[model samples]
Target: MRFNDVIMALLVIVIILMIIIPVPLGWLDFFLALNISLALTILVLSMFVKETLEFSVFPSILLITTLFRLALNISTTRYILSDGKAGEVIDAFGNFVVGGNAIVGFIIFLIIVLIQFLVITKGSERVSEVAARFTLDAMPGKQMAIDADLNSGLITENDAKERRKKIQREADFYGAMDGASKFVKGDAIAGIIITVINILAGFMLGAFTMGYTLSQSIQKFTLLTVGDGLVSQIPALMISVATGIIVTRAASESNLGTDVLSQLFAQSKVLYIVGGVLMLIGIATPLPNLPFITIGIAIMLSALRLTQDKKELEEQAEFESEQEEERDNNDIRKPENIIPLLQVDPIELEFGYGIIPLADPNQGGDLFDRLVMIRRQIALEMGIVVPMIRLRDNIQLDSSEYLIKIKGNDIARGTIVFDHYLAMSPGVVEGEIEGIDTIEPAFGLPAKWIRSEDREKAELLGYTVVDPSSVISTHLTEVIKKHSHELINREDVKQLIENIKESNSALVEELMPNLMSLGDIQKVLSNLLKEFVSVRDLVTILETLADYARSTRDVNILTEYVRQRLSRQLSRTYFPFGKAKVVTLEQSLENMLMEAIEQNENGTFLSIDPMTSQNIVASLAQEVRKLIQMGEQAIVVTAPIVRFYFKRMTEQSIPELVVLSYNEIESDIDIQSAGMVSI
Candidate 1:
């Protein structure tokens, strides 16, 4: 039900109770009935208006009763003076207030007391439940997204893991602290009982003192004292009613419940009822001394309880507010704690050795070996979480002259591309190129000079001759994977092509099919046959040359096996450097990068230096030497270094394209340079 409706319903019930109650019954006075009616009506209005039960309504009730008591005192004085039993009448008035007022006020106050108590109890409960819901629901959903990214290689798994743990720890700490702050239950009721005792004490004392003092001073004065005390009870009575409404409302708002103790201590109605009883005792009882002291004591007790309850309410409000703020924080991880976990860039590599064709025997490597070395070097240095596409290529391989999507120092990248051509193939001539050579000297080979096989192999490996910027979505994990897979397959196909090129197919073709329409298949078969014959002939020749009589079966077989393996090895060797071995490079790179960062007194972080291809290659070679020395596998760093900084390094301070790791570099580390494979 609406709050307004609920309050109206409560007021209606109180009004009905008031109407049915016998007026002036037993010791009840008509004036007392009128006072009860006024208190109840005002309380109902207060509730309906939504005034807070403790602070707002209690203060109002106190002021109202003070006014009512002043009026009552004047009326009693007038009545006593006119009656001619002025002294006797005045004394009787004190007796009437302490005894009769107490009885009548108690009866009437009960009805107002019940209604205020009920409304406040229910309201505070609903507020607390709503608060709990607002704090705990959305955290896990956000964490799931981070988990998926880490698993898919879209983000570093280590970074995601740390972020998740940090969130969990924070949540645990918040929960524990919130639980510790709730108020102790049942404390409110003890407060109310104390309030009642205090009121009784204050009223009795005031009544006794007034009667004794006035009686000693003068007979007429005694009458006047009794009359004034009776009137004074009215304000106390009214203040009691106000206190009752406030405590009741506050308790109800606190949601501590209708437990007798909590209700008594927490309910404002208890104070109001106590106040009313004190007033009645002061006015109706013949014991003038006891009522005043009792009521004063009761007023003090009620005030103390109200103060305490207000503090608890304030505390609870603070807790709920904090819970709500935490709910808001669930949407994003704290940048300071978790932002460092995401990859800054997709791919980064340093290419060393000036841009040149791979087939140059003078440069000391086959085109394919140089390409393989380049890929491995990149994988090691950048933490290869994403694929590095070759932005520059030797044109004799019919590959794009530049690799697209390479992220590294521009000078290093260019020099590496130049070195690739100069060193990879035999008979490739190198010349100083204006644009290619910046701080570092660089050389490039003409396209025609590169072997056709080398060109085919380079193209197969996804080494585009275009600039690195041309590749779309370079940082995306899926795109890099797709490109890497294509390159691998291309390399495989090129190897098969090279096998066909060097074989003596004509000699083997004598045993192959003579179909005109299936020439491609025939050629493939002829190539296969030549490979088999060469293996067979070499094995047969080795067996015949061995001294069979002296040689044991094992020795004879080992010699034949060695000859066949040598023939196959000689045929397959591409890059003069060596076969490119793939390793798990990420751990090593991370360690190297962290070490480098720490080692720098200026706090400069490293990235793959993008310029000076030879420097890029040399830097990679240094990192590879370290990794090889440590004997660790190389893995890729999926995010590129978008920004890095060192404290006190340079005026710019930030490091971008810092060289990370070098690993598995064959003894001939200079053979391959890592290129900046840009994100």
Candidate 2:
């Protein structure tokens, strides 16, 4: 179809024909020249390629060229056996290249064959096999690294995909090379066989059929055979060398020639030492000192020039770096640069200088990797996607301190001693160990900072030993759990709805904008999240809201209905063993709150007197303390009508108290009244 494609097809046809048909001496010379030219071009191209992938088509090209050379060898053998002459190309190589001696020419051809077969071909084959094995072995590790970078927000999804594709391509390239090296090895063996056959057969045909004497036949056929062998073996040698170069080359940004020159001559000091050594040898020996002295002086001058060039390059790089820094400073001074500072990361971690190694991968720290796992864990447990956390260094803080922030406000801060283990008492210790006393930043549990060597001793004493990074990560996890509701907004709600719409489109269309708006649903979900309820079961929550939304527009009432529908989930979270220890209000206090519910346009409020409100709060606080003392959760169970008011009235004073209505408890769970509050 295209010009290059047509030429390639025709060239392949010609190579096939060369093996089946006879060629004149003139054409044989031309084909011999073409073969040599092709081999030389391939050798040069291999030296200039930046990486193996840049010349991915080389394996096919190698097979084609090897076949073409073998075909030419066959055609030249035909002419030599029948006529005792191949072509000028072969004759010139036989006479001029080897001084017109058949013995010398044959010896030289044997040397070329030995070099290509034993050295280049064998070595390249082994290297290709090793490279293929290593590439495949390292594939899993490279894939995991890419996934870690993607999860940590260091690279985008597209970047991770591209990296994975590149790794696969490298593996394929090395595998192809492993198989391609065999072609050159086989070609070398075939060349040896063809040369031996041509010499033996040529002698027989010339002495018997052509009627020449045995000596004359030997002389004439020997020269023709040696010349043909040399013509083919020289090009084969070049190709074998090229194959070795391709397989041995490492992936670099520069071509092979540039890389070799730069690395080999990088240090001028080595050259100067060598030149001095040569001059001393010349002076010590009784040889001609002038020759060695002249060469040494030239080497010394080249070294000096290289040193000057390296210095100029370094100076140029430094000057460019300074100019770039100045440009950045000028850009920072502009008012437009201040706009970015106004926007805050949804979640952020700021560390002091001493703790910087905890986030640096080069220092054997896995903080970033741990953070990626934390996000995945939160999604599974809380049914919410946590945004990428921005980690940075804050020089204003103490060297051992770090802080976690939400919406630009610090929610949790902790101090850790680097190069030490935090040994926390696991409720019981067999004996006391020598260490610095401190508090576990996540739970305020008493802990001791122990030396690295003391970790085993502390663990043997029944204490939980944790590293500094783990301690900080645990604290950050707890803070995120506490502030999850604040992190979610209307956009998150819309995303959840859209995800559900994929499987339940009709349900979403019927419920949204008809019975309630998106904001209304956001409020209901937010209310559920405030008490650590996972809204991952959006189908159930939305169905319940759609059923009750038409009767009342109150978000609190709708959330209560959703909770009742999700009683099994809530019961499992609070009472994993199917039993709940709760604190109930007395009948008189419940009745009093029920009567105080005054409804108006702004919604219902508790219209109780000051003494009544104070007594209610005081009695609940006393009961909460008793539950805490007994190591039981403080849950307040009341009538559904008064549950909202009761929680709203005492939420500020007793935030840890969980207020649940009778309808919100699952029927199968066993309920135990641990305490009762009376006003």
Candidate 3:
């Protein structure tokens, strides 16, 4: 066994022996001294530790010490009642500490008991109860905060896990403390009972059984009983005080003593005022002036010295800060410093200073939390992991302006009034509102920045009103959706495959590492996402890819086959409750495109004439605009052989339009031909 473990086992045996066996006077004195030393050690340690967690073993220590003290009380009581002399430690305390007066000793012991039971122990118990309750109540909020930090990339997974463990430990510690305080309270009560029994039993045994005179018996036994009570109660009082300190100590980087000193004596001016008040009282009051004047002068000198020390420390810190800044500037001039500057966030939001309150929770803003939800929402809607966006403040922009950037390039910018509501007309407003005229950054709709009080009026007038955070979040969501294809890389594809492998290992193993490379799958998935197709159904997409991947090495063909397999998903998404409204190419134009197509092992490319390509694009653009104006999504249906080339042709002109092959539509869904594109 380890040394500490063996010692603890021996200590437990000793405590039991003290309770069951008769203890010699020397041993009783030794145990009493040991108890006092242990309690004193605990008190000093509690004062020095920076935080409660640093002394997490305190609850167990409290129970063990309480038991040890009880055992000692039993042994001392046996010694006093049997022989009328407990120990030399008790004798010294009885005569020297309390002037051999039983009444004075008992009063002092009672004072210690009352102070511990009523003040320190009671207060510590209440604080522990409240701390435990608050910790449990705030657990959900704390966990959510940790998740927000983890999701926002402020902390790593390991850091978040460690923080969660710390929170749990704090809760458990406070709960243990809530129970441990009861041990101290019970110890105080037991001490009182033991002291009373020792006095009554010791006197009877000394006078009647030992045949001593009444006055002699009372003197000897009363002194010993009071002395034993005082020794036990003093140590108990120290422990109770320590318990109060531990429970009441807030978490800080400094120890309790240092924290108290720094905060209580931080201001020299307060000390000066106190010293001045003392001096005035000494001169005015009809009492001894010398003592008060001397102490007041000492306080004034100490305050002056503190002021000087504070100034010197500030000057030293200033010098160190300047030196550090110079060293940093020198380091920044190095090539290594420039290397970090080259690395940019994949997605970022830069806002002006005025918008900081919209992001900072301390200022009643929840933009960071909102952004976390935004990322999750986009992942669910677009079926891709949106990268963590870095939020920062820039002073070069207008105070109310914010911009979204993808890959170090600004893609969208918006401006909002800090404390005003953005009232937008959904289609038309019932009445015009008086406010600052502005364009809504998310949708470019006409909006007015109105007072918060006007929000009800705006809503009553059939206008949609939103706060600044919602405006920024909505803009960021749209920007992410538009650039999701660019965000997916080989790592994301690898992650998806690995996640799938956990449940369908055989299928993933058979398809990956043998049939297609990771890059090839990433390309196909990126191609699907380029048209805003949800790749959430990975089992189906991978299965379709595995079937056709061996025959063709082209990623585009694989993506097209996957799309054909996912036609049902597409049909439901686009045509939720009605027929699929689509525009189709004329037979002549389709044949012309087929004839112009050139195929190779690499891929298919349209080798059409310039005039023919222009005419086709012009005709398609006209029909696409018509469909959009009628509030219908523009989808072009073409033959399976020409779908790829047709999409490629009209991609630049109508990027928002979706082109599907004739075979890609499900047979169950009704189709409506809105128009036809011809050249």
lDDT against the true structure, per candidate, is: 0.36, 0.86, 0.87
Sort the predicted structures by TM-score, highest score first. Answer: 3, 2, 1
Query: How far off is model 1, as Cα RMSD?
Result: 31.1
TM values, all candidates: 0.19, 0.58, 0.61
- The alpha-carbon deviation from the true structure for residue 379 of candidate 2, after best TM-score superposition, in angstroms, is 16
Model 3, 584-662: lDDT tens digits are 9999988988899888877878898888889988999888888888788888999988898899888887787889887
Which of candidates 2 and 3 reaches a greater TM-score? 3
For model 3, the superposed segments whose C-alpha errors exceed 4 Å read 1-10, 150-161, 305-348, 355-401, 407-409, 412-679
Total backbone clashes of candidate 1, pairs 3 or more residues apart or in separate chains = 160
- Which candidate, 1 or 2, has the higher TM-score? 2
Instruction: Tell me the lDDT of model 3 at 577.
Output: 74
The TM-score of candidate 3 is 0.61
Residue 278, candidate 2: alpha-carbon lDDT: 78
Candidate 2: tens digits of C-alpha lDDT, residues 1-679: 6999999999899899989999787888988999999999999999998888777888888889999999999998888887778889988887789888888888888999999999999999999999999888767656755654454344567788999998999899889989998999999899899988988887889899999898888878878888888888888888888888888888588988899998887789988987887788779988789988888888788899999999999999999999999999999999999998899998999999999999999997889987887787677667888888999999998999999999999888989987898888868879999899999987788999999888767766767777787788778877887788888888988999999999999889989999999999989888888888898899999899889999999888898899899999888888888986789989988998898889888766889888878888999999888887888888889988888889988988898789988888889989888889899
lDDT of 1 by residue, 1-679 (tens): 6998799667555444444442222222444445556766654554443324223333333433434433443344334333322233334454554343444433333333333233332332233233223324334433644553343333455768777775564444333323311111111222233324333433444346445343233434333343444333432333344333433342243432334456566666667667767767677777684757577568757866787888899999999999988976873555665764453322332222233323345765344333343444324322122244343333443232323332332312222232132112223323322223212112232322223234333333322222121111122222333233222233343343345336645422332233111233223222222222122232232233232313433322333333333433322322234533322224444344445443244323444344432343344445545545654322111122211221112112211212212321223423233222211
